[model samples]
Target: MNVALVTGGPGAATVGPCTAAPSPDLHYRLPSAFNDASSKNGRAMPIDLDEVPSRGSQCASAGKRRSWIPGAAFLAVLFGSIALAQSPPGTPPPASAPADLRQSKGVLLADRPDDTLLLAVEAFDDGSIGLVVSSLAPRCRVPEDVFDLPVQVDRAGFQLKHVIRQQQPQPDGACAESIATVYQAEHYWPLKTATAVTLHLPWGAVPLNEAGLAYLKSITPARPPPALPDDAATYSGLLDQLTELLAAGRNQEARAAAEKVLPYFVQRPPDEGGRFFGILGTARRRTSDLSLAAASFEVGIRLLEIAGDTHSLGVVSDNLATVRRLQKRLPEAEAASDRAIAAFESLDTPGGKASLGGAYNNRSLILWDQGSPELALVYNEKALALLKVAYRDDPQALRPFLEDNKFLRKAIKTP
Candidate 1:
């Protein structure tokens, strides 16, 4: 009964091409499910990754075949750990960790409890080492001390100590629910002679397995630069500026900025042009300009198709469907939703499956709003089935979608 009604517009998870470098400042918030659940009783209960249900258990309850597909945001967080080495432009750098706590080369350590603590060590070509420490905690209880904690490193390994403080009652005597918070700290050290390194966290010690050690050792001090068009840097800078504006929730400014720079990408490669259009569409949608949003997405889809970027194509197509739905263009919305599902189906990857489920959910909403409750129910069930598989390990993340499905079913059953 923790379900909240699905009001307002559809969920807007931003999208970009998989291979494109993300803006260093771009930070994604946890899904609305977490936000909603945290505030339900004013007790800010964040989902602990350690308590996630087993895949077999979740699948058995859903009565569907279990499939493992990582959510898009989940994967993004994993990859984003490495990018944390440098603070965003204009942000003050944090206090350095003690001298003994030298950083190391970037390698994702496995064999730790998922989503608890992530440590990414990156070795830069400049002989500098970077370490990014990340952990999740309740919004009101961030562990700011993790940044300055001393790390002990020796030929054997490195050890970092962290202790989560208990949540003290708020000044108002009640903790307000807020989105789950991720606290991260970056530290740098001078590179030293190559040595096998192990990370000892408070929970456990994780050694660099053979592959990790080899990867750390094999990193070239410098990489050959790829040939680039003269305007590449300018183009990248423009996109980065736009991404920053959007991430900061400056919707009107982002729309204007996107429009100003969009023409530059028109004659570029399809992927480049498509990426611009996608940003433009997102900005327009956030500004409540549905017509322009749909137009941008349509153009982006064509360019992505020409570029053979099915992932971005699926994403833009879904965005178009949502815009068209808001515009009450049922036929067009349904067609766009179908296209998105088809594009995701072809990819068959974990991110693709997660997106495919979202497309199904979009189609259900469109059908229901178009007065086809029966058909909507069918699509909703299909969406739930796929999402159950996609989020088998993190059922808490699936709560919002489940709540939406429950609402849809109840509405359909009502006289």
Candidate 2:
């Protein structure tokens, strides 16, 4: 249901190819049978990371390399710059709770001239809870690392410490922007009778009041369909076949199938045609046909715009920017990125915001290629901020963007 977008690697930076993960708000429903098959095959089946081409690489060399790593290990490597102290996984809570509860709160726990801490908490339906603490320090101090360590836990609640490390202040008395570092930790304790949580900082204990325990209780979770509807079976089957072909690394076969089906969808409806064109474009791009990919994305963009599908329009436009960048057409790439950013900006939804972040990331690369590192850094920071907001619940998904920001900053600061 999720689509991967290639938004990384401009002209000749050392950074490798980067991809944006699917936002939760942007998903298409496929038949349950097709979903089952995709799951069994160990593929999301739409656009896997391995299918994206690396920038500055020859077209013939596209899709020739694959790097697969475990999710936990990948996260560890991604956040290695930030300190993380993980507690041992706790045992499951007993099954005698009266009712499920979910709540979240963000409170400013400490405010001082040197340091500030904002604490956020979330309690899940299963009696488990998570805490995120953000520490802000003056950039001149060079706050190097931040982490959280669990101190104690029981039915009465839990205790933890927020640790911050910084270097000596710069002698010039010059100051830059404030640096914010985040630390997260989760606990499996049953909180049925818990009253409050305490954070043990270097200064004192900051007790966080849990006044709104029922804030998230009224929210409903989505349930999956029991079976694939008969009316969508045929179309779903065809789409599944194409996705499976791509999943199996048969790019040529997938491209052929997409070409065979593109016309029929194009005649049916604007939305359908737009989606299929995106598929066709992805297929062609995977096969190293940059011109055909750009052409397909153009058609898709027009169709999506006609259908008033701003989300898909943004996606297609972003993909076109990638194609143009790969072709070394900086102006065209920047134009496409602008269109994509505008499309996403018009939408106020979370998916739109995340896609907008992706568009900015693409534009940053193009600017970097055009020898505008300062402007590139600006756009990159914007992308990071938007992406962090959208992916707050799934911080691991921000790995690529985080890496890009790190490398871009290093590049900007290097002589």
At residue 229, give the lDDT of candidate 1.
34
For candidate 2, the clash count comes to 0
Candidate 2 at 250: error in angstroms? 5.2
Model 1: weakest 10-residue lDDT segment is: 177-186
Candidate 2 residues 1-415, lDDT tens each?
Answer: 3223444453422211222212223233434443454322354323211111122222222222212111233222222212222222222321311110011134445456554444444433443233344444453332223322322222222222223332222223322211112221111222222344444443345554444223222222222112222344466466666667667776666765665333234223456556666776777677666665676677677667777888888888998998888877789898989899999999999888999998888888888879998898899889989999988888788877887787888987842
Candidate 2 is scored at a TM of 0.45
TM-scores for all candidates: the values are: 0.44, 0.45
Candidate 2 ranges beyond 4 A from true positions: 1-233, 240-250, 393-395
Scored by CA lDDT, what does every candidate get? 0.49, 0.51
Model 1, runs deviating above 4 Å: 1-234, 392-396
lDDT (10s digit) by residue, model 1, range 1-415: 0000111234543331111212224343323332333322355433222111221232222221111112232223322322332111221211321111123223434422222233444444444333444433222333221111212223311222211111222233321111111212111110122354554333444555666556545543332211223355555655666667777877666665554333234345667666777787787677665554665677677677887888788888888888778777789888998888899899868877887888888888898889987888788778788889989999896887787777877876742
Model 2 lDDT at residue 47: 21
Best by lDDT: 2
